[model samples]
Target: MQIIQSLSEISGRYRALFVDLWGCVHDGVHPFPGAVEALKAYRATGGKVVLVTNSPRPRDGVAEQIAGIGVPADAYDAIATSGDSARLAMYQGAVGTRVWHMGYADESDDGFFTPPAILDDPLAIERVPLERAEGIVCTGPADPYADPSEMRPQFLAAKTRGLKLLCANPDIVVDRGGRREWCAGAYAQLYTEMGGESLYFGKPHPPIYDLARRRLAAIADVGDASILAIGDGPQTDAAGAMGEDLDLLFISGGLGAEETGTAIGGSPDPARLERYLAETGVAPTYVIGTLR
Candidate 1:
């Protein structure tokens, strides 16, 4: 697939843009080339852009991280993250309600633009006893899932509690420096397999996009179909766009290099690709190797 060459083509078609962070804009370490300019050009042509990500950080925290990495703060209008979404979902309850942060949250986790109870110590969650817990919000560091054996403890904990598991990042795993790393979703799947109930609040889950649209509506009265969702992962990004009935710019550049046997995601059979797309019940409006 060809890279999206210029912003002009994307200008008229999309009213507002919901762009993914992490793999699409940065590699967890640095920003991609021309990513900022791409958003600037999109906004220059009268489009409103919102950075939609599954990052476990809040909006301001996300903006700060992106800015530190070279993306211009003015390039996009705002951000919406799964962390904030999870927090929102958590406190839709009575005041002073107890919640177990079944995950890790740091100083950066504060000032989320929405505040909720945060318990950083995973052991506290394990030792605190489950009866006092109202709900379990799982978001923590997952690294080097080289062997499933390494992922055992935490996986077993959530399963043992079987409390309402809130998966902040919907992705099962992601690549870090060419090494595959797990995320909240891996345990989430295990939790489900072990008959533990859970709720995923990010990509491939339509409610996130729904929340994003409602947020965007404050700027412009746009419909869902007019919102373009862009991302690098075909499964999460493309599939999520499909779930929301939005157009997709399936970026082929990033982690998939191995899936394609040429670029991102590595080598995979064409039939498998077709099946992946078919299962979503929504198709991309365009496919590109990069956002350009």
Candidate 2:
């Protein structure tokens, strides 16, 4: 893989970018100034940026959250979230009408249940007890910091009942600032391992990419050949970009910093980076310590 110092080295080659938000742009609590400037500069060159995130929040909700975190409105053109894609499946009855909700209980997660305005007719989805539900809708664990194995009993019971799980965010974990936390994909992986079915809508899976392409198309007529995918997650972003046959710019300073020996505001150690890429089995077109 080519290790590059800045996005400007190859920015002119792509008409659009499918950028991951959590690690590449912000660290959940704050925005990365260099990353923000990179995107803004890219936009100034007439490039469209589609923030394709595996966040379990709708497009507008993500926009609001990012804006609150200091990422300005001009940094991106549009957003396509895993939540919106999974919500479309849920409202289309991927999980039966009566489903059990698994995630944060607070209002911060309420946007996931909101029906999409684009849908002409969405099913009347109901949040019911797991015992009475036909399927499960998992945005994430009620407690992200807790071990995923803690849900084995519930997953086993759901499996016995033949309930399918619709995983909104197919990310195993995310680094919120400096703390690592489990995500919906961890729970979904556990459920599937226990012989339960899990439907994923985010990265490495085709659904979210399709949704992101649609969002990108709404702004520009860019094809996969002219689009670049950027993210920190090796499996999610790198694998997804490879699956979609798009070039990838892997940000090593985020999730894989420790493994790749990437220090903050610095590039990764070449030997460690090669080993990390070999182990992950993903080949990114370009690598950078951060988005800039």
Candidate 3:
């Protein structure tokens, strides 16, 4: 993979960009000014920008959350979220009607329960207790800071009942302002390891990529060859892009900063980056320290 300093160096090669949200455009708590500017600049060149995120929040919720953190609307043309894709599946009876909801009780994840507007005759879902439910819908753990092993007992019960879990976000963990926290994928991984079935609709999975393509199609008729997938997650973004046969620009400074020896606003150590990529078995088209 070729290492570049800025996106402008290769921006002319693609017609659209499938940019990741967390760890690319924002740090969850705030926006990355350079990333935001880079997106705006790309859009100015008549290129489409689709914010493909694994956030469990719906599209509108994600838009609001990013706006609250200073990520302007002009940076991207559209958004496609894993929550929306999973919601569509849930409403289509991927999971049974009576489902057990596993997430924060503070109502921060309330938007996940909303039905997608595209579904005309959506299933009538009911949130019942785990023992009485037919399936489970997981947005994330009730406490992101806690270990996923703590859910073993609950996962065992669900497995015994043969309940299927619909995972909204497939991100194992994300750095929110430099503080790493667990995500829904970690819970799903643990559940699956315990013999429970977990269905994912996020990055590294085909469902979310389909949704992102539809979002891009609504704006312009762009093909897979003209799209560049950009993100920091090797397992999610890199894997997803490879699966879809799209060119990828891997940002080594996000999750791989420590392993790549990349300082803030600085490029990664060439030797370290090569070693890291070799270990992950991911080959991206380009590499950048940050989105800018």
Candidate 4:
């Protein structure tokens, strides 16, 4: 893989960029030093940027959180979140209206139960038990710091009832200021292993990419040839790019850094990165130590 110093090298080649949020833009706690500036600079050069994230929050909620986390309003044009995509699946009648949401009642906002503000639906959402609901929707664990193993029984029980799970975030884990935290994908993976069917609407899944593509198309007339997906996770970001036939720019400092034997926020190691890439078998079009 080619190790690029700056996104500008490939910046001119693409009219639009689908940038990942958590790892590439900011850690859960703070924005990366040069990440915001890089995106702002890209937009200033007439590039349309869409913040694509596997966050289970609705697009508006994600946007607000990012803004609070220090990413300026002008850094990107639009946001397409997995929560929004998952809700669309529900709206399209892919799953039943009544959902048994598996996430923290306190940590979650109304976005988890209601439609996005863009849709302006007047109906209020009500939560039900797994037996009463027609399907399961897991935004994440009930506790932010809870282990995926703690929720295994619940997932398996839902599976026994033939309930399909809608995984809003397909990220197995994410870095929360250098600490790895379990995400919805971790639970979904275990559920799948236990013969549970799941519908994922995030990175590495075509549905989320399709939502991102539509958001990008709304702002600019760009094709897949002129679009690049920038992210740090190989299984989620790079694999998703590959599935959507989009180019990938992988950052080797966040979620995947551990596999490369590189500590979080450390300089990139070309040798270890190469080995890690080979192990994962996901080839990115470009590689950067971080999203500068």
Error of 4 at 268 (Å): 2.0
Question: Which number leads on lDDT?
Answer: 3
Q: TM-scores for all candidates?
A: 0.80, 0.98, 0.98, 0.93
**Model 4, 1-292: lDDT tens per residue?**
6888778888999999999999899998899988898898899999999999999888888988988889888999999999888877765555577778787547755476676555655344456987788788888877667777777777777888888888888998888887877888888888888898989889888888888989988888888999999998888899999888898998887777767665544556778888888988889898887787
Local accuracy of candidate 3 as per-residue lDDT tens digits, 135-186: 9999988988999999898889999999999999999999999999999999
TM-score of 1: 0.80
Candidate 4 CA-lDDT value: 0.83
Off by over 4 Å in 3: none
How many pairs of residues collide in model 1?
A: 14
The 0-to-1 C-alpha lDDT of every candidate, in the order given, reads: 0.66, 0.92, 0.93, 0.83
In terms of lDDT, model 3 sits at 0.93
State the displacement of the C-alpha of residue 108, model 4, in Å, after optimal TM-score superposition: 3.3
RMSD of each: 5.2, 0.9, 0.9, 2.1
* Residue 108 displacement in candidate 3 (angstroms): 3.5
Superposition-based RMSD of candidate 1 using all C-alpha atoms, in angstroms = 5.2
Whole-model lDDT, candidate 1?
0.66
